[model samples]
Target chain A: MARASVTRLTGRPLLSRRQDGLALRRAMPDRLLPALVAAMTFLAALALAGAVGASLLAQRWNNGAAAIMTIQVPDADAPAATGAGKRGDAVLAVLSHDPAFAAAIPVDRARLAALLAPWLGGAGGSGTGAPALSLPGVIQARLRPGVDPPADLAARLESAAPGTLAERNQPWTARLVALTRSLQACAALALLVVTGVAVAVVAAATRAGLAARRHSIEIVHGLGAGDGYIAGRFARRTTVLALSGGIIGTILSVPLLLLLCRLGAPFASGAALPPTLPDGDLAAYLSDALARVPLPLWIALPLLPPVSASIGWLTAQFTVRAWLRRLP
Target chain B: MIRLDEIALRYPGRDPNRGAVLQRISADIPSGGFRWVLGASGAGKSSLLRLLSLSLKPTSGQLEVLGVSVNRARRAALARLRRRTGTVFQDLRLLGELSVFDNVALRLRLDGLPEDRIELEVTEMLRFVGLGRKLDVRPHSLSGGEQQRVAVARAVVHRPPLLLADEPTGALDEKQAIRLISLFEELNQMGSTVLVATHNEALVRRFGHPALVLERGRLVSHG
Candidate 1:
């Protein structure tokens, strides 16, 4: 009869060495505080890195292409008799002839007035006073995604239209680019630091665990349990603690990120909320929903806990084994 | 049965300043018999018990247990033989984290006894040691006398043919000491060979077992 089946039939499975080990573990004192501390420290580091990294990745990939530049050219200088209509025709002709200029959409007068309403103030209704003319003859150029305007593209445009100055509006793009890069670098450094700290903490904890269990290890040797059995127990305990700590740490850190996004909104411009980037959208919308979602906790949080816990458990096992060799 | 013919055990000098704990010594323990080893501290009485327990090997000489020459024994075979002989350590080798029941069950567990059999044997041993009520309690919670009983229970629970105790009753009061002795006597009556190493001359004198007396690492008398 099969051993397991026989046991099930008899209602008492024969005791195996494996069952004895489990029973022994059940009888042993569980050092919860040390185990929990080791776990929490390990977990917190991972959660910190995970949350920041997820946000950075989302921002980099999703909202990455948001800031765009548009240039406007009113119809080419019209005849002095009907300057407005003729200038518009000339501008359209110049845009059609230029190779650097890909797609130029002329904005009508009403739309231009609406676009300038925020800066110029007062809703543009029939009764509203005529707004001060700001650059009457301008051509609007929309650059392709990721395509940097050639240095001479601006110069050529100015040359095409006398008394017109070509501006790239480079300040906002430069600032956004700098902000994204800075966040990425900061996230990377934070993760590295967390990993280093977890390793050190686990190593110290392993050493302490070995010291406390020295007598038990010797007892194990005396009982004829070899290095493998002894090591297995320590490894099991450490690994469980690390995984638990990781879960708790992840739970704690994600909400902080959501709060930070909320605090930062007033300072950030509407342009910062770019539609072309999904990450930007996530940062904007998911920050609130995921503020409690804890997605990054699940993703980036296991980095150091397993490594640290494994190292700690292994160190304790090998050290005790080496000590046992000197006992007899 | 254990035979150490012309066995010479030594602790190698770590430096010129340090000396060997045991010099070469020869002895034999007959099968299914009881032997008591006597010596003062530093006389290597514990060392001899360690050798017999197979916890230590002779620096030189032939060592055999159960007719198998241990010098020629493979590590796996050595472990197997060691598991068959239970030792009661002088320091009382009880895992403090484990309950008294589990500690006693360890020997049977090592021998791969069935769980039901292990429980039955552990219960019987605890009853014999007067720790039946303390089965679920840990060693640290027990008094020294009670702890020594737990250790004795652990050693004899598996019914190893050879049982070696090093100062098994050192911490017990006179009454408890007598009880511990009677426990060993009961094991000896059950066909298990017993060797006890102790400096307690009064107990040995009263018990009247054949003695192996060691003086300065040498076997000075056998009676």
Candidate 2:
């Protein structure tokens, strides 16, 4: 309410132009120094985890359509000995007639046999042996694209095929989803713990500064400077510390995260493919998802460190302001 | 101009019966004059200063400073009033962390004076107080007399219309007290109203000035 001119409290300005760099350096000892290394390590871990979790969720969400399971039913007259012919007919009848099954397009024998060629060794392996040994009777039906298979769909299919068992591919997908969520929660918890520690450290340092400068405040008051002027100095100092510490902490965490990500690349690469894609070429799976993922992570992963730093700065500012209000 | 009419003050204590520290007592110190309020320990001299300085409001009377009715003034107006005056504490409240030059420059700077002006004015004041050589030295490193002078320099730096000094030379030798009192006289000559609360009778006789004496929370005499 007091629209007075902005008063400078001393010959020294609140923030010097060129001296900001020097001030930032000075801030390191008081604010940034202690938390710098820890903050970096914590933030890097947080960012990497966040990137990984987000990527996993996005990958799962994006790849919702790719979770395919096929049951191949053998030909009607292949033989009655393996019970393959009867089961194959039964599957065809259910898929075509059951209203619950919107459309199940059966693949031709040649295509199904071709699909299995790589795993069963189509012809002869260079000096290895013949490809086909024995084959199981299975009905491969491609469910209507983009339609979610219901929980009871498997039961219905099993009932339809009297002697056949139905298998759903979603349980493994659900497990992967749960793991991603758990990792995200763990990262979030660690970030919170680091934030708490940062605030506590800054608060303690500020209190010590206040105690040392108690006479400075009293003298200013005695010289007719009010509470606002005294508080302004403290708020400015701590804020600088918070921001600088954040920057330093973030800088430190990046390289550490890169190293860890590099080390974990092999395991993550293996996870991108299904066991059914039995060629097992590491390069193929690497190309399948890893390439798509790193870009998203690279773009989004760098944001966490700065965000953590801002949290630190904000906490320090509020704490100092609250402490100053108690002064007479 | 400072006026306290039928003023009363009290501090929270162990006993409730002794409610008011200074009962309904009225006093005034006119503008452009020096007034030495003489009182022994616990005689409420400092309480009067507190009331005049707008540090504490009187419980039961109207008070004014520089023709502004402080009792009815807004918080902003009161702060303006406070800024227009300066008080040197009995404890010589100089910011020990800052150098002597900085301590003196504080008041002017708070009023938003430019850096060059602050530098010139602070230099002049430090010179006047004979601490020019020790400009960059912090107060805690200074001697008792030098520290008291720095406190004086800070109080008078802004050249406020009103000045309050509580035992300004309480820790000084007789010669130093005389020099300090002369500075106060010079300020008064320049039209700043001066009020000194002291018990130093020898110093009072040394520099003959009008005096107001207090005893047992009551005004004993005025001259």
**TM-score of each model, in listed order:** 0.63, 0.69
For A211-293, candidate 1 gives per-residue lDDT tens digits of 66666666766766655565566656655655555555554555554554444433332224323235666555664534433
How well is each residue in B1-223 modelled by candidate 2, as lDDT tens digits? 6776777777645265756767767667789978898988988888888777776767777787889997798655666777799787778766654677777777787787775666667778888788878877878899988898888888888888999888888878888788888988888899999989988889788888888787777777766
Model 1: per-residue Cα lDDT over B33-92, one tens digit each: 888998888888899888888778888888888777989976557677777788999888
Question: Which prediction has the highest DockQ against the true structure?
Answer: 1
After superposition, candidate 1 runs with Cα above 4 Å error: A1-179, A203-217, A228-244, A263-288, A291-298, A301-328, B1-18, B25-41, B51-84, B95-99, B109-114, B127-149, B160-162, B168-195, B198-213, B219-223
List the TM-score for candidate 2's chain B: 0.93
What are the lDDT figures for the candidates, one per model? Answer: 0.65, 0.64
Write model 2 residue lDDT over A251-279, tens digit each, in one string.
66555555445444444443433332248
